[model samples]
Target: MNSGLNFLQTNVNKDFTTLKKNLKKDFTGLKKIKVALLGDSATQFLNQALRACAYEQGFEFEIYEADYNQVSRQLLDLSSDLYQFAPEFVIVFESTQKLQHKFNSLQKSERLQLSELKTEEVKNYYHTLNRQLKAKLIYFNFSEPMDGQFGNYSNKTSFSFLYQVRKLNLELMNLSQECKNLFILDYQALSAHLGRQMAFDAKMFYGASMNLSIDGLPLVAKNCCDIISAINGKFKKCLILDLDNTMWGGIIGDDGIENIEVGDLGNGKAFSDLQQWARQLKQRGIILAVCSKNDEQTAKEPFLKHPEMVLRLDDIAVFVANWNNKADNIRYIQSILNIGFDAMVFLDDNPFERNLVRTNLPEVEVPELPEDPSMYLEYLSALNLFETASYSEEDELRNKHYQQEAGRVIAQKNFTNEDDFLKSLGMTSKVEPVNKFNLPRVAQLSQRSNQFNLRTVRYTEEDVLQISQSENYFTLTFDLKDKFGDNGLICVVVLKKEVSALFIETWLMSCRVLKRGMENFTLNTIVEVAKKNNFKKIQGEYLATSKNGMVKEHYARLGFSEAGQLWELNIENYQTKKSFIQLN
Candidate 1:
């Protein structure tokens, strides 16, 4: 029985029957989440598949499945079962078959307005549900259907079903961007990936109004679970690559840089394509690292000299190329990253190396490389390992941030006194309330920060925005900069006012800025806020999770006295803590 974190490390069975068997397994101790599933078509199979797939991902979903064709009623009525259940995620799966039926009933003039009307309907559903509940909306986009009425000419007309479906998909994307709580599930892409014949069963639809075939239910369920897991902050953040034969064809030492199969060389296109894909991932904020079992100079030769290489040295945050075991090298990389093993993915061509890493670091995701180099990218892409819930401008600069941290590490070795080293850095921090400018990064940190987080409460951008506008809540964001480089938005604190006391709702900081006395600076700021507002006391709590054990004694170490299950500090008794970081 693999834990949720280890399931993706190997190519575990995803067969529908196999997933169904997971329902019988012990679900004790799994993280419980509430989900409400509403579909126009029959959703019994989808509901079952979702529960089973969620079990494999280490979640026990308490699902509230609405009766068939109850999407509108469940969403519009505030006192409905959906509202009563108060689910964390509300999935709206509207079948394309049902959409086509609605389109066919419209007059020819109304047919031209089908996409617009349907988009508005979905927008209404989202807004109504959002106003009533804080649950995130996961709506499925329609898969394209070729009605053959206009044949190839449908591209020229807006009234055609094919044209309308494509327009509806685009409209849904636009709507999702406008509405922060709304998320569009790419059902169209999934159907295209599995092909029409396999995705939809005509006989099953005719008999039982099942839009998805039995074979495809597990995949659809898995996709839904992936989005949910990502929203909960369990997504991959790093990609570790092997150099010889994995990044390029042939051994770098034996084949030489010029003879390496990259660019227009032998079987070079596949390797080049993989590198291009990796570069795109890096640009999107996924940290890239190298863990190769070779001489450092030899492993770096191709990246430095090979013109066909898509990846450059600057693209990698940590590069470990030595004659040591790959597992130890990966562990070293993890240390520099300061992230959990579950957040990293290691790609290698050698089965022995992959197995060794899997056996030792079971939490690290290790995908099985196909025998043929041509199939590598295709297989990895299908896994969808890098699903993310949010993106910000700060993400693009993550590589540079890590590279600067490396410089700090080397500089620390030269100084003996910790105080002198800290003062030498000349660190400055800018503290401000949450606003439109930094809301995305604040919400992203809330989801991504785990180890240093006192209470692991994940929040979406919508949730953060609402809290920012509430008078009952006080928010603070910290931006750190030193002589080396800027570590953008390193810490966030949220406090809720209750009579004469301020309760700390959230206190999470990036692991990158840990041990720099940032925690003291943050606490000093929190105390300042409490005193300025005339609050008599401040209260905080530490909620333990599998990954946040590092901060279990955080309150105790910060001079907070234990009060029942909570930590408390009287504002009058609190003294300002000293920190090297100056407020800017």
Candidate 2:
């Protein structure tokens, strides 16, 4: 660790000092990415590293620093120099304490106003301090020392401190909805990757040795590299944790489910600790699955019977606990989940098992866990590797949902008619023009949707808002409710007026809501919008893609005439056809 630190400090000084020495003298014409760094000493290092990175990338980075613990200073610093910098990206560090510092200052003001702040407006408030957001991408870094330097203090990574950090997570999640490219880069997530391999003790550096010792500092250069990499490539989707001593201490296959330690006492406590932490990950909506070689029934017994099993079997989306190779199991889980190799994080105590998955599923991320059992908590806690800037409570039940949907598919064989099966779902669809609230989900669906999408026109939250506020265009989303559950915002539609015709700009639905006549109802709504807009005709296109063959003839199904190469639905011709879904 000491050697690693010495090597790291030397690397940082070399990287940063070299960048500063080669600083571009001309700041005028080159595309300037104005960046503001907020917080204390640790944050300064982050800016320096980022500036050097920017320099190496051959870009001019104009940087502004705000006083530590000075929320007023944050406000003041932005108002004066933000516009001057004209930052293409705003990287806010020491941000975990933003709300706390604001509250403390409000206590000082005595008349601090909370109502005056709007979730979206609070972001623009920064613009009032600096310049308008030229580059709308905002990356937030929430990292503090385990020694209780920045965030709340605790001896054993206390619940209170983790709770505050979680709060910061939620705030950024909500905040991200208000802006395009709002990213929360978990500093702790990136640092934990280095573990004991690096050092973060405040006093870890000294002189040329210090120059070589930057890795000892928390949030080292490698940590920066990982975060940038994660942001460049989106976070993984599934966390495939190994059972045996990994999920809980001791192997259930060897020790029997009842005897396997995982409760409030002895080795049980360690398993319980891991189970408890895993539940939080589920809550954030990241899919949790099991990939271990064990007797399937015996392994499941503990989760079902153990009162201390915080990770109930239902909480897990999939389990491939068999005698088969772990890599094969991961492939099986990924098949049903329909996610990318880059989206899965494999957690296993055995280096052999971890390495097997790495070699076979090279895209699957396998983060290192320290060898010592006592190091489990910090090793896992420090490696905050997953990122979900967009999350919801519904994410918690995602696994159970896949199971229920599977059951529904099995039950579908019982129905003689398709409408009977669809009606049995008790499906209800509520469609309205996209407003500020639905803009987030609508934009998210557009960004992620592929298969069921008629036209994959992705838009930002701001872009969605702009379309809605336009007189010539309209955008809207649908809320789907069924006997199973509320599907949340599951569909989107965008329409615009071009020439004297109604043009369907984009139409997409969550694949989860597909087989139900939601498509027909959605098209009916489009025609009504066209009728209301007094268009002579309506037009739409089918951008041929490998996956969208399911809806290739969608315009023809709506009784549109195949005119030339384009699909056209003149209002008079549309009225002649009786293509409409009977909304029950």
Candidate 3:
């Protein structure tokens, strides 16, 4: 019972019946999130499936289901129940069948304009909802209808329903890029994966007006829950790879670099494709680490010498290749990375290794790779392990930053005094108010940073933008750099001005910058801002979360006096803290 197989059996194989049974499970302590589901077809079953699946994902969904087929009405009307619900997420589901009916009603000339017209309508709905509500919008792209009207010619003709649906899906993706809060769920991908037979029930559509089949409901719910979980800051951040049979065909130590299968060799295409996939993940900020039980030099041979190897040594943030127990090696990697075990995905072909890691560190996600080498990519693709809520320029440079952190670690050993080391690094930071350029990363930090986050208030780009523009709120973003490299936008602070005191609404920093006097620099900066703004006192609070215990005494260490639940600092009495970092 490996974790991969167990995950598939428990979650992917769960049908409507099994999901319904989950509704009875106690959801007392699970995190509660409000969701408003709006659909153009019957969505009672979808609503139930979402709630049940969310429970399994450790979320108790408080869903507000709009009246059947009232997507436009609920969004257009300001005083509607949708607005009253004040959901954190709004899921807009427009069935393909309903979309087809609208297309069929138009003239032949207008048929070609179907996608354009529908895209505008969707944009209107999104803009209307966004203006009224601060909720993140999750819009379902239409699954192409299997109408044999034009047969294979539908792709060739722009007027066909198939063409319109696909074009609409592409337009939705483009729109999502423009709209920061908009998230387009690939319903078309999910439907195609499930196949037309399972995804749609003609009988159910006629009998109950439900477009999604009972068999397909759980998967749809799972995908939706995956998005919700990601937006709420629970998603994979790192991918751990096992060499030999895992990354390539045959063992590196046994087969040798030239003999190992990769690229055009025997069963090489599979391993090559997997490496390419891992490379893409790395490019998108998922830190890549290696944990293998092999002789250090032997494991390094393929990556260094093999022409077919897609991953280079430079691509890997952390490389641990020794005969150490993989569980212990992974623990060491986690220590350096400073990320949660649950936020990492371990991919290894050997069942024994996967099981060992799973048994020792149950929080780490070890997918059960298929026995066959060829099916590796397909199986992993279906799992959708890396679901992200946001991406920015900062994300692209994540691996390089980690590599620089490694450099800083090596540099630290030369100095006995911490202050001397900090000063030697020549640390400088660019402090600026959050604007259009850094809004995405600021919002992303608000969502992704759990360990260092005070108050644990998650914000979307929309929220960050609103705060940035408000007179009552002041925002600060820190970009740190040293002799090693630049740690892009490492810290975010949001301050709210009260009558006399300035309150810290949000204060989060990248853990990589810990013990570098960045905190002292940040506080000194904060005090300067308070004096400039004529604030009498600065107030901060440490809201305890399961992961944020490290910051429990953050205010106390900074010389803030505890005043009941809040920590207060008098600006006039505050002395500047010593910091090696200078403003850039």
lDDT against the true structure, per candidate, is 0.91, 0.62, 0.90
Q: Which stretches of candidate 2 lie over 4 Å from their true place?
A: 1-88, 92-125, 128-134, 137-233, 413-424, 436-439, 446-466, 503-506, 514-517, 536-572, 575-584
Best by lDDT: 1
- TM-score of candidate 2 to 2 decimals: 0.65
Where is the poorest 10-residue window by lDDT in model 1?
1-10
Residues 335-405 of candidate 2 have per-residue lDDT tens digits of 66766677788888899998888899888988766665555765566544664434434556666665566
lDDT (10s digit) by residue, model 1, range 36-78: 9999988999999999999977899999999989999999998
Off by over 4 Å in 3: 1-13
lDDT of the structure predicted as candidate 3: 0.90
- Quick one: ranking by lDDT, best first? 1, 3, 2
lDDT, candidate 3, residue 464?
92
RMSD of each: 3.4, 8.7, 2.6
| lDDT: the better of candidates 1 and 3 | 1
